[model samples]
Target: MASITASYPWTTAPLIAGAPMRLISGPSLVHAISAAGGIGFLAAGTDVSTLSENLSAFKSLLSTSPIPGAPSDVLPIGVGFILWGADLKLAVKALSELPEPPAAVWLFAPSSSEELGSWANGIRSATKNKSKIWVQASCVADAIEAIKVANPDVFVIQGADAGGHGRYASAGLISLVPELIDAVREYYGNLNGGGDTSSFPSPPKFVAAGGIADERGVNAILALGADGAALGTRFLAAEEAVIRKGYQDAVLKAEDGGNNTIRTDVYDKLRGTIGWPEGYGGRGVINLSYVDAIKGVSFEENEKLYKVAEGAGDKGWEEGNARMTTYAGTAVGLVKKVAKAGDIVRELRGQRI
Candidate 1:
């Protein structure tokens, strides 16, 4: 099996990725990262209503600012989809019509491998194998399951500290990433029939996601046997990200994530954005909403207050009294300021492991 870097030949070694953050990572951010020798994924999360338009925007940018190793037949970028709510038919049709399909497709939060398999099959057929499959696994079990079902080209081992929706009670990457790597090697190593190596699908490359903010974090994941590092929270500070200025300010102001951030469904409940799978919750900076919830505030009262905060606009995220959700990973403290997405990618890339 080739390293994850081998599959993404366009990328510089020590592959850095801007995670496909829903409503945040947009065409410009994705293009910037890809243009800077890293891969970025545009968020399609739960809704591809604007998928075609977004793809067109990305293509437009590519024409004006083309990057190295960009194949004429495929766009050197990726699109992320949250499978639990995404319309599979719409996704397939959107990609099928693209003049140059995205180079990769990231699938996350599927209800089951069966559901993931269906999407994978549809996507491969739509892109005609031009796009590679990237499956996000929250634990070792999900890795084994994806290998059996989707046979993903890349395994994104998402740790507990990741921002946004993720499995609850998951381990940090320090333990999770290496464990998954060992499990994958064992699964494939046992199937190597006298080194013939063709009896089963090639082993997938590992990309560690969660609590990674800088080159040191990237180096740590690389040293753990992962082929790549994918960043979500750090990119929230990127100038090209489609994020509210107030929200971005909150991200810059937060610190001591292990103490300030938490994983819970309170944000989802108050925001009225429920429908995640059972074991999933989001990590975000602690705010009045979380504090009130912890103090046994009734759901009715909390929702009412959240509605008022919603009307407050950007003031909702003021540092002294934050009310809105600031979804981010633990390493958010390391993200000190805003920079261009391309500069952020170039700055975050670490030495090849």
Candidate 2:
């Protein structure tokens, strides 16, 4: 079967990648997925101050306790960044100084295609290594534009049902993936004199993201023309994910087959995450805080409630008080338990859960 490993460093076929969930996806999670024959990306988008410490820890872990099934000596891990939220130069500098550079650098939500190219060029010049460049897009226009200007090695097409921040008007994977595939094909066709099949090149590989939680979702997206699948919500409950137990339980309990989640910016606003480029919002499990916000509760009132929840600590999460955010996709219902990260990767890759 065709696989992204052909262009990237992974050895796994039917690639199942772990989405870079900020604060949730850590070195342990990435190592677990990579060791399980799938690729994983470390979330370096937020809290840039900890980048060095995190990268060092990842290098130490890889050096001392190597992941069993990973490709020999290749690190088998990537680092992802929220382009709009991170300083590209500093991020690149930090990664360049790493004892072991990542297998790839994943970028998302760039302000413009030129920014994407600039980041890609910086990494290329800094490392002088063959680390692949992967970019995420939520629509055909952005996908085509990335192909035209940035020419990233991989294009992760995120559907609207995906968890976390994404384009407000994103289309579902079923339609978006095929649309991107056709768009890429057409772009290449146009470049080669309208019909020069001989010169047609296959450069950027496509991976489907958002709401893919199981083997069936993987199979469906692959059949839809994606070379692989990237899952976020499904991994939220993984043992290695750096999430509170309360948040994990919320995902496990929200098994309503996509009916229990809402895509909105209430949590972002409540958390003071302003200046996120327009047309982007997050999909998360519905809770009292969200409901209260939707009910037109004033920010001051909601802030007070949030503080109470925060003060309650783990108890707040355990009681479903909604003090903390539970970012999940429509696939929350499909995740039934907290399993090892490696097991989750295997399960999504068709192994029994």
Say which candidate scores most in lDDT.
Answer: 1
Q: Per-candidate RMSD vs. true structure? A: 2.1, 2.1
Q: Candidates' TM-scores? A: 0.96, 0.94
Query: In candidate 1, what are the lDDT values of residues 269-324, reduced to their tens digit?
Result: 98888789899999999999999999999999988888887788899898555788
User: Local distance difference test, per candidate?
Assistant: 0.89, 0.81
Error of 1 at 62 (Å): 0.7
The residue pairs in collision within model 1 are: none
Worst 10 residues of 1 by lDDT: 191-200
